[model samples]
Target chain A: MLEVKDLRAGFEGSEIIKGISLSIKAGEVHAIMGPNGSGKSTLAKVLAGHPSYEVTGGEVIYNGENLLEIEPEQRALKGIFMGFQYPVEIPGVNNAEFLRMAYNARQINEGKEELDPLDFDDILTEKMKMLSMEKKYRERNLNDGFSGGEKKKNEILQMAILQPKLAVLDETDSGLDIDALRVVSDGVNKIKSADNALILITHYQRLLEYIQPDYVHVLSQGIIVKSGEKDLALELEAQGYDWLTPTN
Target chain B: MTTTLVDASDQAESALLNLHKKFMSGNRPPEALVPLNEAAIQRFELLKFPHRKHEMYTFVNTKELVSTVFNLPGETVVSKDFIKSHVYPECESSYLVVVDGILNEDLSDNSAIQSSINLVPLKDAVDQPEIKEYLADTIEKENDVFSAINTAFISQGTLIDVAAKKQVEAPLQILHVSTGSASGNVTSHPRILVRLGELAEFKMIVKYVGVQGNYFVNSVMDILVGEQAGVTFSQVQEDATDAWHYSKTRVQQGRNSRVKAVNAFFGNKITRHHFEAHLKDVGAELLLNSVSILNDAEQVHHFVRIHHEAPHTNSTQNFKNIVNDKSRSSVDGTVIVNQGAQQIFSDQLINNLMLSDNAHADNKPNLMIFADDVKCTHGATVGQLDENQLFYLKTRGLSEKVAKELLTKSFAESIVQTIDFPGVVDYLENTLLKKLEA
Candidate 1:
């Protein structure tokens, strides 16, 4: 469902991720474990086509479509979702309004009938139920005064409502509490199907307990150095990333 | 100096001398600070109108009317039914009215007005020697010629005294309407004096509308909030297309008091002016907001002065302007904190949405603080609507006009978000629709 070949990205002129590649199949959860500044977030942002991160090299193929040249918003329309590590706080924009806009942006690209307010409300209530979230989350300002946990939960709620073919969760667990993490993971799990995929990026083994990835990859410096089954997460959790780096 | 705007004939000399004589005597309205006013007028007469070298009045060129004697029309608006139909009542509180720059019995509702709210016309207040003494000692001003000119004209204005520990039921509305021009230029000074007592709560809306054409309106409103008095003051101006409105407001807030003012200018040829909250005692707060949609050759200039005088003073200043056509706008925000006033928190934000390449907006929001413990922030930005956001909205099914309306609402949400009164919000939205025709 998702493919990346020799992906390289950075901020401005300084390249960070030298060259890296990874792939994930449908219904499979892939965890990218790396230390801070190890390009774990960069991979997600670059795949999502963040304008600040220039794709210095490589192509990202999502469902047989090359997404390197598409706009970040267009990539979202093409069923590519990147849960930002730090979502920008856009004040004065309503949460429901933003979600409706994102949903309609994709619908426009797909040539589908955009839902009206009543229709969108009906859809939203069902998604909120599936995601095990409250209905009031849609009325507040867009992450303006939201707590870290609430912001993360709202991101998952977006993922559930958007229902992208391939969803990437980047550092969604850093700030969430245990209950919020469980709810968010449940939301991610509910959206997964035979034709959908999710990429979980985390430094700890806690989120792995909820999502249970089929494949675990140990990313170091700018590249993924190890690829294995779910057991690699437990080993890495016990030892940590300091032991994975090659000694000079 | 732009004194050269005066004619060279004998008429000019006598006019200048007539101007000096008319401005120098009895210059302070309500007879407030008579000596200071007289001395200030002397200094003001010595200097001519500011020239292009002065950056403060750079975009405001008043060379057209500096030489004209705009007579105050004698046909006073004295119909009681007309006043009752037009002006909102303050019978449960206090209110006053100035008809053709003179306090009229038919215009003001004073007697039977709530005892908690003391409503007195400035002319009648002047007749009371003790009240005149109190005003003459307390009110102060620098040598601003126009303000002093307002004093010399000394027509009439309402004196509203809201008693301490009283909350007025309805908003106190002061309606100032213009009519009947007698010459090339006709002017009227509708003065307003409001003194909200301690711990009292009130909302005052000053509405300015013109019924006739080619008139000049010089209006000033003075508000003094006593300790712990909470007040919300707003001004709505939708003057006639052929009129010019010059309005200035000066307010003083006392200890633990809250004073907020929003000025919405939807008029022709207006120069909106202000000085606010010069003395903020402990825990006193002030909020100033202005919104304008400029069109054609109309020019709107907003001058704001926020001074924090005591510790723990809080203030906010925001003005959103949308300028189209060849219109020009200027916002001059000056915030100052005294040397002894500590822990002052102040913010000034000005945003202009320019709809035409030739339209212009000059925004200067500044702060001067002598205190050490303070939080101050000021910013100004002029930009067209974001193309990405606009395109995104259009693609989402909102038409271009609806999208523009939403964008404008978003731009103004911060100010309206703080407004709690439904009538104010509804009236403002209706006036906005009628003003913009969108």
Candidate 2:
């Protein structure tokens, strides 16, 4: 479902994702893990069309469309979702109102009828229950004063609503407690299907325990140095990245 | 001494001269208002008209606006349909319609209002000494050109007096409509005086609307909140594109009195508003909130001053402006804490959002503290919408326009949400949404 070829990206003339390539099929979950400053988060942002990063070389293809050529909003409309490491705080925009707009935008893109606030409330209630979010979360400002766990759960709730073809989870488990991590991973695990793919980017193998991945790739210095099965994560967790460093 | 009227616009000179000549010719001058008119005209002749060089009129040019020769407005011929269509539909309240500067009793309905609240035309109550006192007391006669002009020509107005310890259930709606004269440009001077007795609670809405034409409107409002009284006053200005308007609201609060004021300016060619509040005794509170949404080449200016005379007083001022096209808006606010006014808390915040390169906003906040123990802070911000917030909305599949519209709506929503009237809130929300979409 996703193909990346020699993707080279960076910010302001400094190369971050230096010459990397990866391909993943449908129904597959890929976990990209590495130590700090290893370009793990940069790769996720590059694929999600973050305007800050200038793709100096290579391309990304998704569902036969050149995803790199599209805008971030177009990428989203075409079933691509990015769960940020730090969700922004929009003080005045209501969370439910924002979710409805996103849902309706996608509906319009797919040539389907839009749902009004009353109609969308039921769907939102079911999703909130799945993530154990309180009703107050919907009425509050979008991530304005939400706790660390609430923000992460809200992101996953959006993922469930968008039902994107490819989901990029960037440090989704960084600030979450044990129970929140399980809830988030459980939400992601339930959404996984035969036609969708997810890329889990994390520094610890803690999240892998809840939502196991089919492939684990060790990334260092902007390049995927090794690719292996789930056992590779256990190995990296036991021994730090010093043993896996490529040493140029 | 022959007043020189130095550095004045030709139009302002002409307008003042015409009005003076008419007044001197004994054109139905009331016996009680002759001295007041004479004094105001003398002050007008002395001060002339304020220009850009004047400190208070720095960013606005009053020369061109005062130069236009507006026909002296008289009784207007308005249809019932016009009056009905223009009334605010959101809230069902008693309406007092002032047409072309005259209080139209036939058009005003006060049957629904509580009996404890008194609504009467100033002209009818001019015989009472208290009516004369309010008219002469609230506004400053010296150094204020517009208020003097309004006083010099005050013919019709409304006087609302609330009974002591009485709470009015429904809001009082004062609708001021200016319909251009048959011949040419017309000007209207409307006045309002609201007095709430001790422990009285009331809410009032003042709406200024005009038809499309060359018209000038000068309005003055005097509000007095008694001891332990609470009043919420909301004003909306939606004038014609060619209309020029100047309004001043002066408030005096007694011990422990509270006042909440909100003003929204959405239309006008040239609009200027002045708000002054004096906290006379301890524990008085004031909240002054305003929003200006300007587009095209329109201009709006707001000048506010709050005086804390007694200790333990609190005041808050929040103002926002959204400018598009080549429009310009400015706000100048000053909070003064007297020497004995210790333990006072004051905060002022001004935020401006510029949608285009040509749009401009000038914000000035001043704090004068004579007491060392007072807590006062003021800050102003000017910029476009947050790029990250916009991008986040876009990533949620919203178009750029929708994203910006939502963000702009959010900025204004912070103030509009404080309005408890649902109909007024909905109307303001839709109005702001339309402006954002445009």
Instruction: Please name the candidate that would achieve the greatest lDDT relative to the true structure.
Output: 2
**Which lDDT tens digits does candidate 2 get at residues B159-208?**
78897999988877888989875467887788888889999999888888
Residue B32, model 2: lDDT of 62
TM-score of each: 0.81, 0.88
Question: What is the RMSD of candidate 2?
Answer: 3.6
Q: List the residue pairs that clash in candidate 2.
A: B11-B67
lDDT of candidate 2 over A50-75, digit per residue (tens): 77889999989999999899988899
Residues B32-141 of candidate 1 have per-residue lDDT tens digits of 43443455345445544444454556557665545455555547454655555545433223345555556555566644445557767676766666556645543344
For all candidates, the clash counts are 2, 1
| Cα error of candidate 1 at position A34, Å | 2.2
